[model samples]
Target: MKKISITFLLVLISLIAQAQFTFKGTIANYSNKRILVKIDRAFDDILIGNITTNSNGSFSIPVKDNYSGIIEISLLDAKKNYIFISDNTDIDFSASITTNDEFIINIPGNQINERYQNYLNYDIKKNSILPQLQNINFYYNSKDDFYLPLKNEIQRISEMNEPDISEFPFLSYYLKTSDLIKNTEIGNGDAISNKNLILDHFKNAGQQFETSGVGKSLLYNYFKLSAMGATSQKDWENKIDKAIEVLLDEVGEETSRGQEILSATINFLNGYGLVNLTDKYMKRAESLTCEISAELKKTIQDNNSIKEGKIIPNIKFTHKLNDKYTYLYDIKTKYKLIMVWASWCSHCQQEMPYVKQFYENFKKSGGEIIALSVDYNKEDWQNAIKETSWLNDSDLIYWDSKFVKELNITGTPTLILVDQKNKILKITSKISDINNLIK
Candidate 1:
């Protein structure tokens, strides 16, 4: 009996040692029903789990055992507002949606996240030059007047936060990139000269940041900056492909770091409607030992499905006004514009007016518009439709709808142009492309 009792105690202790951590938090004014918990896997975001939030906006997500790293908890509705988690630590915090500044995060036991919050609070308080910086288009033209002040401000912040940022790879990379941009020499000349200098600086910085292992977001920004010099979409695609090739060669495609950079590059390009380059990059990624993520695999499949001549899969939607179910294939018209969007998407909201105007012209030419909303809340979806001209023509699918998954819709305002037979003509996120299709 004594021996059995000792064994049971030992087993209990072992189980306790391997227990997973719990993360619980409350978000005020956030009506989203679900929260996505993702861990940073190289340059990709691997979905760990989804937590169902209570009606009062409180959530609890369990961190699986043996996995300890930086995790991002994002509300399904407002993905931009993410709560960063570090280590396998428990966190309980309350954040406000109305607050434009830093949201208060109260972590009792975790020093890493506490430190991060402190740094974030400090940066938010000190970032006064962002508005001024936004006004200056540094890629199109160099403003010497804007450069000095921006450079000084960045330098000042780096100096002030050196102690706090040294331990954080993401913050360290950010400071380093800002310093590099500040120190770069810009020559006064024609637009071509200015663009060349900008591209050169970004390319140089991108090469350096590619190896940093800090995070994908910084590297993505660098790639965007580097591609800004391209004169057209085709030119941009060529430039980006060349840049990727150079990067792969420099880092060695078989290396983990090289695969990380490649993965991020592929995701960035795909997000910008650059599906033409995805196949080439994806094939290169497959050659590497690193396992391709399910999300990427789905993306590759989706890209293939919507290629120029392929027949798009039918999208079934229940109309918001009458609750009548309709199929995309059933809509017989000369041309059909299937727009996947959401109420929370600022870009979608901004482009709706123009889309309406284009639809007016397009309808006259026997074109049909099917505006799909992926809003989570029924009330929000209805309100969005009521506010816009889309009330008569809109259908709601909410989040992670079958249509969204089938179409591989990542970001909103995704425009798909189809012929009478449901054959896809063009797939783009740009509003200006609608006019081209009409013409």
Candidate 2:
């Protein structure tokens, strides 16, 4: 019976206008590198800007005029990212990649970051060493000569705790719910042995932490692991229902917080490829005595929109890829490929040329490629499609376009294959897989 605060259901997602601040840094060995700055919005990221290091590997960029909180730095590759908290002070840091490939950051004149960095270093060490030691201990005989010292070291490290920098209130709460911490029995490769513990953590973690990106990850990972542990599909479905029941227990059923939680859970399931579990959420929401909000209901409806064998909504061609094809349904082709792409995504750019090359063959088979751009800028969308004559259009709403969410275009270059009736035949990211489908 832990307390779960319902303030905003997202404290970090909404940018607060704190006193202006900037983050100054130096990256070792990577000079003049383009970096992607993003702020956490629950499970999603709002792109801040692109920054590049100077020749000396030094860079300075203001966090944002009205934003201060959790930020992600994607250096070069999208995955080689690190997190930092910017406060009232000008934070300075020096960073480099470790031999083990962990991003090692050290911020001077900031005890909060100092403590956090120490914990990251410590966590990486523990993650690297402990599991192997666990296997050794599992395999070796207790009477072995190496057992005593190895066991003692393992015990000491396991008992050791991160330095208490809880004096910084927000960070203290953040660490509690962060993906790096296993107090919730959930993280990468963490087995969900205790479902109650995760629910308890979600309940106990305050509004600020529980409503952030870390919170979303915990819930997503919990469901993923739980789904794996289920004895059967029926068992999995039951667990999903039971989880929602416990989370909503004794809480204000009519409140938006409950609704937001349900919405987030549904999105998480969709992101995790748990299509069947997503259907259950709408069922649960609809059957409830209290009226579900339009937003929540819309989320459920959108998720169900593009299921396999479901006829997708017919789209008007605002900027038709082919001048001959005025609407999505107007195409006389036997099959269609809905290429949901964005202009800014490098991966999408790479995929476009291949898609263009494949279009002729696909068209010969009575299949047409309908390019749907998810760009918010009309000019950008136009520039991107200059080379292709596919039947296409962009709402210019980025991801907020109704169909983008409905069709579940989670990333750029998502290919949705459908028949003449627009019944979704296949949805995949790989171009090679769908090549066989067209033939």
Candidate 3:
């Protein structure tokens, strides 16, 4: 019994030892003092570790069991190198910052990485011919006329390299799936026919190659393509919802990939100001059996706060000119335009004039403007106000303001429109589109 217990302990220790991995590399002409090692986790890049290079420009990063999948080694101002890492493997590579050539990888007795390096070399050679192929476009009159020759050239290159891809499953899968996506994107003729082709490619590729990074990217692109088929906003919402359903069915909801797809879809809907659809999708995501990431959960919560039809948070601020505190609810107008701006934002500087014009036209129709400055320095905020004649009622609050957190103001020049009862109506960043909302 004593001997058996000792053997079991030894085996457990060996397994644990095998789980750790190391990556060491040397950079030629390495100007950067530190190198960052990041692991690609679905839609997010997680920083696993960092290494300060020695005087000889060599660095080593020890990757724990927590990191898997694609690894990226980023050198400051230099091109990044990507590699697939597994347990117990020590991957060594030498990269040159001056050249665009592939890194010289040395993973002793790893056939997969060896083949990958060879494939990368071949791919680089193929890419070198792309400029010449693009030059073939001079013969064509228009972009529509150039598609056939370009497609033919792609087919020729794919066929010529068939032998090289025979042993590499991942590369083969990437090439075929990429070709299918390309065809779906460039397909000509009737809109219905194009839509059918896109759907067919998506359904087929998504089912067959739903396990890799490339596959996830293809599926995401498929969702974008599906959105293009919609003729109206209502149709777009329905189509996007159906696409999400199909994706959830293809890749079960209890997976990282599934959560990534849901997060991306929610972000897409949010970008277009489709608050209703975004909320619906967020609810669907939450209802799933999968573990929701904290970041994604926060995103859903923040978006819900400013979603249309939801009441705007009652925020009080002391008006800079009057030095009197005013509640947002006290703003007596049929509609309120809250413009979040900062003195440092160049985009805000450019859009201020258009916003001024919109406010002039809008205030005449029972609308009110509240120019809120998020600048940390009170003097800079005051000076910016002096430059503008249209800003009458302005407030200043640094980033620490509770209203900033409630609104989730990520960038400057954000426009939020609310009705008299403080019911959120429209939220957008495009200041020029304020006319559409007022009208």
Candidate 4:
């Protein structure tokens, strides 16, 4: 039989089971501080591990594959309390005060935390409940009281819990605002056919996570982002050559250096999906990033491991803004972005109006965007850059900033960019891709 149906479709295309789970337990009243157990790690940010509480008050931590996270337990007589864990469910508890006690025995049941909580409930119903119902109809003109709470938050992201349409970017920005609210002629006509039936129920809930193969790079990046927003240059070069042959066979069998940095972020999203479908797909996305940097410079010059471009890894951080701070090859910028933030981040306050509109359009086409502010506070980084006028070159580094301990930058709206001989063209969290270096 066709070789047992091609060995059952290569055992169902390498069934990625156990998305992660085994948060071994024991956290009972810090027998001298050391709990930091963080977990959210599949593709960057959050994975510190530690456990110490035995002088009669246990502590243990290990969690992977039932993904949804946030399990902080920091101790010194209890105050750190971020606990949301959904899916591979074991979480033993007992945190006390007035003479302390903390315990969380064992937790396991992660069917990849119901598939990373249906890709974080379809990215909190397309970036926080349909962009907070278009910012409450752009400050209250009530689209019939925000259209049935935006179809009950797009039916709570079509009943969330397994919706990993290949790292769904808010289910491709709610199917590109449901084709501009379905072939325009703006708003109501039954609220644009109930916003095109909640973007045709997130395009049939992304074909049930593309029939459970968990979003083959989000179904070839929502068909090369709906054929490059309908300019369909030959259907966005046949969906960026089937999403760069399934992201170059999942970035050459990603055997986890965190899935090889999510296979170099699916080869920088297949080189920005062939630089948005042709200058011959940006010369086949710069020849697939020069054939993965000439097969990682012929496997690092056949294992001598340090030449072909040695000037690459330097990113540390720690300049501690004022109390005397200046690291990051000690300040000087013709062009620099460095950015990174945290003041109880709301996507670092919605990426400060796209990094203050790319630092006022890269300083009116001259460029320089420092910003730093890891906020240990010099008045919450001068009241969030004086309520976000965000004129560039602001600083306040703290969080141990020698460019965040040479770019270990755990996370918080990370940026980087650098130039005028600082070199690095991008590190990106995509605030309008730092105008691809003064365009």
Query: Best by lDDT, which number?
Result: 2
lDDT of 3 by residue, 327-439 (tens): 77767788888888877789988887788777677878898777777664456677888855443343333443456766877667788899889988887777766677675
Scored against the true structure, residue 135 in model 2 reaches a CA lDDT of 79
Clashes of each: 0, 3, 0, 43
- Between prediction 1 and prediction 3, which has the larger lDDT? 3
Overall local distance difference test of candidate 2 = 0.69
Instruction: List, residue by residue over 32-126, the lDDT tens digit for candidate 2.
Output: 77666667654456666666789977877666565445776776435455787644456778887666656666554266677777776677658
lDDT for each candidate structure: 0.63, 0.69, 0.64, 0.47
Per-residue lDDT of 1-439 in model 4, one digit per residue for the tens? 9999999988865553422444544434545444545543222234345455677555655464544434444444223433434334565444433443444323222443344345555666776676666555445444677667666665665565545445544334434433443433233344335433433433344322212222333333334343444365666567545544444344443222212323333434433533343233233333443234433333223222111222224433333444333445444556666676755568888877777776777776656565665554355566667755432232243343344434545457777676666666666666876666566
Model 2: colliding residue pairs: 321-390, 321-391, 321-392
As a TM-score, model 1 comes out at 0.60
Which 10 consecutive residues of model 2 have the lowest summed lDDT? 1-10
Point to the candidate with the largest TM-score.
Answer: 2
- Each candidate structure's TM-score, on Cα atoms with residue i matched to residue i, is 0.60, 0.61, 0.52, 0.24
Clashes counted in candidate 3 amount to 0
| Candidate number that wins on TM-score, 2 or 3 | 2
Which consecutive 10 residues in model 1 have the weakest lDDT in total?
A: 182-191
Instruction: Give candidate 4's error at residue 160 in angstroms.
Output: 28
Candidate scoring better on TM-score of 1 and 2: 2
